[model samples]
Target: MNNEVNLETYEEKKLRLIAILQQHSAPEIRLAKNTSNLFRDRKNISGPGLNVKSFNRVIRIVPEEGFAEVEGMTPYVDLVEECLKYNVMPPVVPQLKSITIGGAVTGIGIESSSFKYGLVHETLQEMDILLADGSSLTCSPHNEHKRLFFGFPNSYGTLGYALKLKIRVVPVKPFVHLTHIRHRDAISYFADLDNHCKQHIDFIDGTIFGPGEYYLTVGKFTESAPYTSDYTYKNIYYRSIRERESDYLHVGDYIWRWDTDWFWCSEYFLGQNPIVRRLLGPKRLNSVTYTKLMHLNRKYNLTHYFNTLLGYHSEAVIQDVEIPLKHCPEYLDFYFNTIKFTPVWVCPIRPLNKNARFPLYPLDPETLYVNFGFWNVIKSRKQTEPGYYNRMVEKKVRDLDGMKSLYSDAYYSAEQFWEIYNQEEYFKLKNRYDPRGRFKDLYAKCVQHG
Candidate 1:
């Protein structure tokens, strides 16, 4: 089977898929290896999926044109390394290095640079997609397939399978000069972030450790630096900045800096023991590496077992809520008073373009929004019910006219989900592209009303 799969070329893969689709009523399409991890419980709803992992390749780089065309399964790490040789990179590389171009494009991908570039999909120049009927088309922002292109992001592969993507890349320096600015309140932190976004900063994000305590971090790309620390080899940027300070990071290091400790979440397990900390360090136990290794441990499924046991005492509620800037203070108070999660990530992102047809895009295009990432372990029984806290947070976000990241577990009914998103537009695209319902709808798979 492996040999036959290897012999099949890209065209052959599409032909085989068309044959399979004709035989079956609906077929799942696996664009990349382990892409199922993006879904909860690693579930794929479509019947007998078509695997396109072999298509992982970097086709070409047009440095002069400021764009790179890569196969859908191409990982961000591979794409970034190739682009770095030409001193250019995707404007918004997702924080995780293992994330693929297809996943990032189909799903929403954001980073510190999001404040300027919007989401990863906003930087896409064009994409080659295989539709449900086994037909292929190249799509762009202002072309014949503009509707599909605009509605692709946050769709989670319900529209089509991304075969090839031409994404916008920007020139970069060798290092990034980072400054950690401390703020005692949400108002001041956002005020400072607003100022920096107006400047020529390359990256911007913040961490809210507790109520009224925040650290707004900003970075600028530079040709050279006097001092530098490689995050892949050293401590995470957030932990290293115990006090207000400045530092420099190699371009690659700066891009995947959060991968070291998975944005400091790994510390919960690896930092508990001194000997283990000395032996493995946070880098080895990095989220991506750790998850890959755990997937290899077949005997016990260590990652699931460990996390499940940990939840017995203290459950971890990890989610990202994008709230309008005007209601940020109210949301923050509710978050701290009700949810009480710690080590929250605060990122300011521009509203999606009014012309963007993606239903999940923020509704209020006139307002600036902040993504509050609540990743904390809670022990309280009141907050530990199956979906109690999730429902609570979801309702609060809806009340504020905000949207929660669908990548995380959502506890909204189909009606509630559509209420927050542009349901009419979504159904229109779904009907046109996937009329047979061959692809799994995002709402059915991700949102849990029960």
Candidate 2:
């Protein structure tokens, strides 16, 4: 459970953060949090950070009401642990253990449950935001700050920093029953996926093995399981999907199944091998540890040097974009013929609140969208310009009328970026909430890397 928030201490910390921000008049404010799940590195953004690290705590969980009040910096792992004690969990828990609730809402968070409950921000009930002016205000759908409440999801801390958040939680059972349905054709596969979403399912996500192989995993909460398979170490979760028709996992383990392997990215560090797994143990075999090692590799340019020595032009293509469900097959076809990568993670998400439109990250309220996530380095014998592959992705997504999550590398021109992410509304919100421009605008922070 980590630590529970104290009533008085939360107030003290809020006042401290406000005073700190007031004392430091720098316009480029960022949170002084310890962990991050962001993929892209900031180039030169520098300013004194608000020390929000102490705000990581679960405030309270009301099981009967199916909601939990938590500090913005509380990680999903800690939030889940505390909620599970009451036999409930957040409606949509992001796969990563280190992602903070604030980070998830601001960036983007989606999991298997997203098909039913929508994305992480869509599940939020209320938020307490610390505006750039160092004033705190509570916002909800029916509150006076309703515009900020809806617009804050994709703001990435530009509008304000969420000091506390309340999210919807659902009851959980002892186990989860998973049924893996395999499909060979993309059209029929997506059709079946949309069909399954109509059912009263607890979780739905797909894994694309290749052009010829696809798997739709449907999970349901159950009271018991005959036996549960472990993928925390040694065994891998993705490989098991193709090898089995049905599987069982303890509820907690199922929520975190993809995290143990970082959705099959652990092989880069040899964490998948049995011997390596034994040496690293469970504690070290997580995204937090892997991210640290990745930083070291970046510091030393280990992968870069190796790729250069091999005479290959490399581009890191790590992105997540959601295309309309009807156009998913077309998206998949382009992906197979172009930025080819195997085992793409797909999760379906539609607005849980159809009447509520989040202008910053707009989606057709009636349309179902499937998020395609592929993270890997793309290399070729021939050389190309920077963002060569990512630009192709941005163009494709634009042509398809899809939305891209800005947590990773984005290669959009200012005009193109604004056109896709509602520039008019963003400026209006900025002028209203942060007229002084105390924080970087979405374009500078995301596209220009500040």
Candidate 3:
């Protein structure tokens, strides 16, 4: 159960990994302590030498080029603070501060501004990767190793381990001029979201609190802070909107605002009483701390049992599906009328490069997408198990030509997954780069089974 690996220089780590591979078969690449809940049941194979977490360092910033180069293990919070000194930030900062740049690049990470910038991988200009054989190479979108670069996203580190990355950053003002618009139904909510995207708003996202009730938030970077709220100390945007009509927030505050409540899920444990929340402080219950504690104490299993007794379902039921713009209303109807999960989150994202090696689901570059996040509890039915609901949603996403984020459980069969993703090209590259099968197979590790 020892999880620690001796720290070493980048070159020394690479040589050590090569030496280890020569002796043992393939070992698991353990980065952060947090595991993606979707792959909770999957066990990592033993026999590794290098741990990239030791490489956590912010190398430097190039203000003229509008980019920053940092080691793969650098956390989002650290990156943001460094970038803020130059008045520039990553185009889409994932909601959680603990998410690492390497994790986000390999996995999918999005935010309010994703509607314009696509996923975190798309914002990456170049990356330094260590292949399975321990060779290092720098790749970019137009480089000779372009296939490895584009196919790397959604690969789950099977292709290679990211050592360093140069990511695109944008200049920002001191604060965000926030506006809240209420919508009575899915049709109007989406319509307004479309308008906001067309107008090129700096940031946009909404919450479907209940059937026919939604709140659409749009923000623009500005130096003027007519009225600013203490979102960090007082309340998260989701809760604060209930009391105030509108208010501004420090740019950093607005970016990680969802961290306070982990997108309103913390209320389940902390209680809905504002007085209690003030006394306890939201930082104590932030998602990173909560997840680490659950893992350390094995309390997650206890929570699952308690949920079943209380008629609630497992945390695995939480999921996010990205649907094409045209099919958003249809998916919303399915979510509200059929599944009955409340407070669904909605955010828009543009399509990635069509010719890219790894094809994002619903790989229509001409079309936009609406990410529908259902992060709530569910009740099991008599004829169906709790997993039945998730599989049904997965089928619907496939039917609508959409893609479900890999961060959640995927119920697709080997054949079904191939149909949804470009499996042939991915496997071809995997064979070329990791012929020994040292890394975890994406399907075997992530695909769920009964």
Candidate 4:
């Protein structure tokens, strides 16, 4: 490790970054980072990526203040490990380890803690955003850039990049006690899901194996557990939901329970195989390794080729959609009926601050919403048009007054996308912060994957 580089102050790093940005003469700006948790692919850009890799650092953790100052490209893994040193953790730590604090805010991030703290963005107290013009400014709920603060949540980096963020952190217990509440019916299951969110708890989320099998797993922080469970290696967390009714984990293990298997999506890369897992070991069992392998598979078109050879048409339905709690059961019914993909994730969340509304990703402040996260390919023996299933998901979400996270493939046209994502508010911020069009528009970046 370079102690000198690590000791460089935030101001020193900022100046160096500005110099690098000035030297790079590109028509467009994009982050040059080491990791990504995004599921979407982008069109090649004819410009050098802005090297913000060194911006990865934790400025400070003020336990008394209940916040941690983290750099833009700092991954949650790094941030969480540091926060834990102070016996504190981010209020809403996204499941994936590689997910950056900046990316999550600009894109959208949520977790099991969302029922109490809301989305990762909601845990934000303030941030200093580095704009396309190589300028930076602090934005908060009641600052001159208040609009930018509220509008930044779902911008997808179209507006600017969060260079530094002050995010809410809460003290953590040494262990977490988990209880899996099983529900055979969607109506009763979803009803109880909403009911549980009203109760005081540390973390809560749900999972579905198939029709008539739903597990609402709840966790409460504890000083100690009877015996801690380990999902980081051989034993899978998602599968454990069905095997055990109650469980316990160390605080760190509980916070990162999903990342070990990428919420069961690791099966795509055979990371679950006993032989493969043993050979790979715990180090390679994470989402980072699987994500890299997935990218490689996409680059080689191996899956498509095999599917064609096997006479199967597949559509990747990797998405997280938020539906009003009352209509979640309906969405579940439609999902099970149409998609039929088992082991979909279910997390309930509502606006942490009812008075604040993020226009770019609007949600009814008064209503609780259930986030359905399903990442798998839907295969058919027959051929279908591109985005056939994804289009269906978009339409159904719209019909039910739901909002979909834009981290993966989307089929929404420009007009329809704008209507849902608050085009007026987005453009206003774009005009104010990036009037020269130095960055790609949200529609082009997300929908077109430019």
Off by over 4 Å in 2: 1-5
Least well predicted 10-residue stretch by lDDT in candidate 2? 1-10
Against the reference, the lDDT scores of all candidates come to 0.75, 0.90, 0.74, 0.89
Where does candidate 1 stray beyond 4 Å?
1-32, 35-39, 42-48, 271-274, 281-283, 293-315, 352-357, 382-384, 448-450
Model 4 over residues 1-450: C-alpha lDDT tens digits?
221323357778887887877676888999889988777887886666988898788888888889888889999999999999989999988898999999999888988888878888899999988888888899999999999999999998899888889899999999999999999898999889988998999888999999899999999999977899999998999999999999999999998899989999888888899999999999988888988888888778888889989999988899999999888878988997898887899998888998998999998888888899998888899788999999999999999999999999999999999999999999999999999998999999999989
lDDT of 2 at 91: 91
Q: What is the lDDT of residue 173 in candidate 3?
A: 93
Predicted structure 3, TM vs. truth: 0.89
Tell me the tens digit of each residue's lDDT in model 3 across 212-319.
Answer: 788888889988887777755455668765555577889988887887677777666653467867776766646675456545434356666776687765545668
After TM-score superposition, the amount by which residue 202's alpha carbon in candidate 3 deviates from its true location, in angstroms, is 0.6
Residue 30 displacement (Å), model 1: 5.2
Model 1 has an lDDT value of 0.75
What tens digits encode model 1's per-residue C-alpha lDDT throughout 202-261?
Answer: 899988888867888889999999988866644555676556479898999899888777
**Candidate 3 structure lDDT:** 0.74
Which pairs clash in the backbone of model 4?
Answer: none
Report how far off residue 415 is in candidate 1 (Å). Answer: 1.2
Decoy 4 TM-score against native: 0.97
